[model samples]
Target: MDTTHRKKNEQNNHPRKGITEFDSNRATLRGKNIFPPFYVKTTVPLQEALKNGEVRNNTHLLVIERNAQILALLTQQMNYHHVAQGEIAGEPWMVSL
Candidate 1:
């Protein structure tokens, strides 16, 4: 794969904006407008997320993701605390203490 050509090719390309389906168990909230090459998923409990500041005071969902695509994933959103770990689908939790 040519890195320069690839980068140039994607310079004008744009991802279709939309939320992925959960039925596939690979739901990805597209970051089309802001970060077209990125997406997110969350499955952690809402409170755990708040403690880690993964979501705001009013977030209702946590989207988690697996290791599949070469994409940028934002696990948590916070100023100081970020405790999210890489979680793969159908696999055991990889984080310990």
Candidate 2:
């Protein structure tokens, strides 16, 4: 994932009120989390939820990767916004909302 846009937004200290489709792909959902393995496997639908006002701050969504048995929870962080990058075995990726 490219941090160019994330960094730019971070510099301005702007909180994303809604997630556009363009930004949906950034979530990088794994296929196993979705209904079927052949599905889009993208968080775009979740982004649409935010865009459509279906969720609010402090709202968290959990995704379970059946294959890997990994649990991913996505939530927005009102403060301390920063993306910590790195991968650890058996550890799921965590991003601020």
Candidate 3:
């Protein structure tokens, strides 16, 4: 019997047939809730951010400019969130780090 067919039959007979098998070699985590994407709901002005100590002179930023409008996000914040989304120039935009 073919190995692929044998494996398929084995999976079908298993109780967790519908669930995906984990592959450590490839580091696949199909069902794991790791690194969920973050959504940006609101934004603060640069002055307010500065006043709140959210931004510093040396803080790195990811900036996007479109249709004369600009959007900026802190790199440190993005590092943990992994993904962020916002609107720019009336269009939807997404950024991933």
Candidate 4:
């Protein structure tokens, strides 16, 4: 066999040699967004949210405070989205878990 053909055969015989090859036929969720990003547009007062049972005392929160203003996001919601974005103090921010 030619040198090139011999080298190709050797590579094909090794499991790790073509590890980087991407097989589109085997891609199950290709070009899909499994976890769409979550955005927080409107917010309610913490006290009111608690009163309405929107947030419980034991609920985990990702909190950010600036200029004496506080923004809290539910960690459980963020877990499903994998990413959460919001505007705080006129500045945009994102959190990824």
Candidate 5:
């Protein structure tokens, strides 16, 4: 058999590891907002916050603070493949991370 063909076959037979690598390097806590914080009405519109740098992709845990008081704890899983196979019912801005 040809060397190139043998290599291709080997690659095809190997089990791919995508999630393991992503989980290892992915962020686990909210560092800082890239943009100035602004009050927005809807959570679904929050994608603009991420894009415009108001909220950061680096933020794994979100805290809603108002007037120096802690409001809530946001425990979120921002994995890339979290919603892989489902079609979104509404037109929410998607962050294709």
Candidate 6:
């Protein structure tokens, strides 16, 4: 059988399936408790969180919510800046999407 067929069989027979090799490492990280939920905010500025020690440079995900809906997922490498007045400023960069 082809790889797709094999994967489908695995999904039918196993409780956990559709997990690609790349997801395996992320699973390990979760299993080992290596990563924790980073800062989550809506109106609260990320820079304020950083200055208040609620977030660090290694913070990967910024869960932003607006009007009870998730506005965006600010992933790692997302360009951002903190102003002198402790304001977070920046827009998500588009890469030929």
Segments of candidate 2 deviating more than 4 angstroms: 1-44, 67-97
**Cα error, candidate 5, residue 35 (Å):** 36
State which candidate has the highest lDDT.
4
**What's the distance in Å from true for residue 40, model 3?**
0.9
- Itemize residue pairs with steric clashes in candidate 5: 35-53
Q: Model 1, 22-66: lDDT tens per residue?
A: 455456666543322221245555566579987676554334444
Off by over 4 Å in 4: 1-29, 66-68
Model 6 TM: 0.25
Give the Cα lDDT of each candidate.
0.44, 0.47, 0.80, 0.86, 0.43, 0.46
* Ten-residue region with minimum lDDT total, candidate 3: 26-35
Ranking by TM-score: 4, 3, 6, 2, 1, 5
Tell me the spans in candidate 3 whose CA falls farther than 4 Å from its real position: 1-27
Best by TM-score: 4
- Enumerate residue pairs that collide in model 4: none
1-97 per-residue lDDT for model 5 (tens digits): 9999999889877777233455545566557544333322234345666688855767664444444433222234333222211113332222222
TM-score of 3: 0.62
For residues 1-97, what per-residue lDDT tens digits would candidate 2 score against the true structure? 4799888777677565454547665678675533211212334455666788876555865454543544344433222333322233435454332
Taking all chains together, each candidate's TM-score versus the true structure is 0.21, 0.22, 0.62, 0.63, 0.20, 0.25
The worst-scoring run of ten residues by lDDT in candidate 2 lies at 33-42
Q: What TM-score quantifies how close candidate 5 is to the native fold?
A: 0.20
Error of 3 at 19 (Å): 27
Q: For model 3, which pairs clash?
A: none
For candidate 4, give the lDDT. Answer: 0.86
